[model samples]
Target: MFFSVIIPTYNRLPILKKCLTALEHQSNHNSVENYEVILVDDGSTDGTLKWLQDHQLEFPHVRWFCQTHQGPAAARNLGVQQAEGDTIIFIDSDLVVTENFLKAHATALIQASKISDRVFTYGRVINTCNFEYPTAEPYKITDFSAAYFATGNVAIARHWLIEAGLFDTQFHLYGWEDLELGVRLKKLGLTLIKCPDAVGYHWHPPFALEQLPNLIEREIQRGRMGVLFYQKHPSLEVKLMIQMTILHQVLWGILSVGGRLNERTMAGVLQWLINQGKPQLALEIARIFLNWYNVRAVYAAYREL
Candidate 1:
């Protein structure tokens, strides 16, 4: 089946270069006839549009589009609406994949369709900060994701997305849009077939003290949007996924000393870890309070609602 890889990007021009170049060089080991990369820019303040325009010759397989500052949920919906292929692969602009990425997803999807039509393929994503050689990074325990259907790397039929009502554009914030779509897909009997061979190296800047305020804001946004997710589904699973449960409240509360051990309190320790060249560990440790911030935000949003 032909593939349309839908990627929604914001101000991520540097990594988007690697992501698009990787998609451009994908090998057709499964003999897939054609694959297109649909890049929907989410109103980036950076020079992403001009750069993509200038480097058009480098990305011949890309079918690019742009929208206002709506979140990725709206961007992916636009991509799916404009996609020319039957199969659609959702990925972030920060993910750089191997040459066989599309081929692996296509092959697994074709095989799964033989058994059942309602099936999609999920690929591996390894996080790294090395922009020079992102693929060289090895998988770590921190990289393990138990998420059943995150959009970092997953392929589905275009028709299935339309049937599931596409992504709800109400998710105008930082998170939970993809997993909310996953809930609808799950109800439609879609099976997730794992394709570990199709790997994507997720690139992000190393954690620094300067990023704390933005990171904390993202957690708060995620918490608020997560409430929207549960408002739509209103199920136990959605509640758990959004960390809206009392258990999450107690867990993060105790872990963060009822919000005292926060970014301000732990700034020195986090900075020391970064100075010691352990940014990942620093980020993980910072999550202790970040999660508490999220839990508090979610509860506050719930109260507002």
Candidate 2:
């Protein structure tokens, strides 16, 4: 089946280059009958549009669309509206994939379609910060995700997305948009078939003490968006997913000591981990306070409602 890989990108031009490059070289085993990359630029000031326009020859299968500085939700909506393929594949602009990525997805999706038309294939995503060789990163326990329908790497029929009303534009923040859409798709009786062969390496900067403020802000934004998610679909499952339940509040509160063991308190330890070449460990430890901030922020947003 032909595929439309939808990518919504902001100022992540560096990794986006690698992402696009990887897509341009899908395995020969996968027949390319108009397989295209639908890159929707979310009003990036980082010259992403110009780079794509000038380097059109480099990415022969790319068709980019532009919009104002709306969030990824809006950008992805635009991509879906303009996509020409029968099947849509979603991946972030920071994810670089293997040469056989599309082939694996196509194989699994075709097999699923043979069994039943109401199924989507979810791929594996390995997180790495090694820009020089992102695909080389091995799978780790930290890479495990229990998400039902994450947009990082997944392929689904275009009609299913249209039926689900696409992503909620109200999620104009850092998180929960994809999961919120997943909730809708789930209700529509869409089965998620795991495709372990389809792999994408998710790239992000190594954890640094200097990034703590932005990371904290991300957690807060996620919390606010999580509230929006619950407002739309109030359920016990969503409550757990967004960490809005009393259990989450109590868990994060105790782990963070009511915000006592925060960025300021854990600054030295975090940096020491980074200096010791263990940024992943540092990030995990930082999650203690980050989750506390999120739990508090979700309650605050709920109160504001």
Per residue, candidate 2 scores C-alpha lDDT tens digits across 152-198 of 99999999999999998999989999999999999999999999899
The models' CA-based lDDT, in order, is 0.92, 0.93
lDDT of 2: 0.93
lDDT of 1 by residue, 114-153 (tens): 8999998999999999999999999888888878789999
The alpha-carbon deviation from the true structure for residue 248 of candidate 2, after best TM-score superposition, in angstroms, is 0.8
Clashes of each: 0, 0
TM-score of predicted model 2?
0.98
User: In model 2, what is the error at residue 28, expressed in angstroms?
Assistant: 1.9
- Stretches of candidate 1 above 4 Å error? none
- Per-candidate TM equals 0.98, 0.98
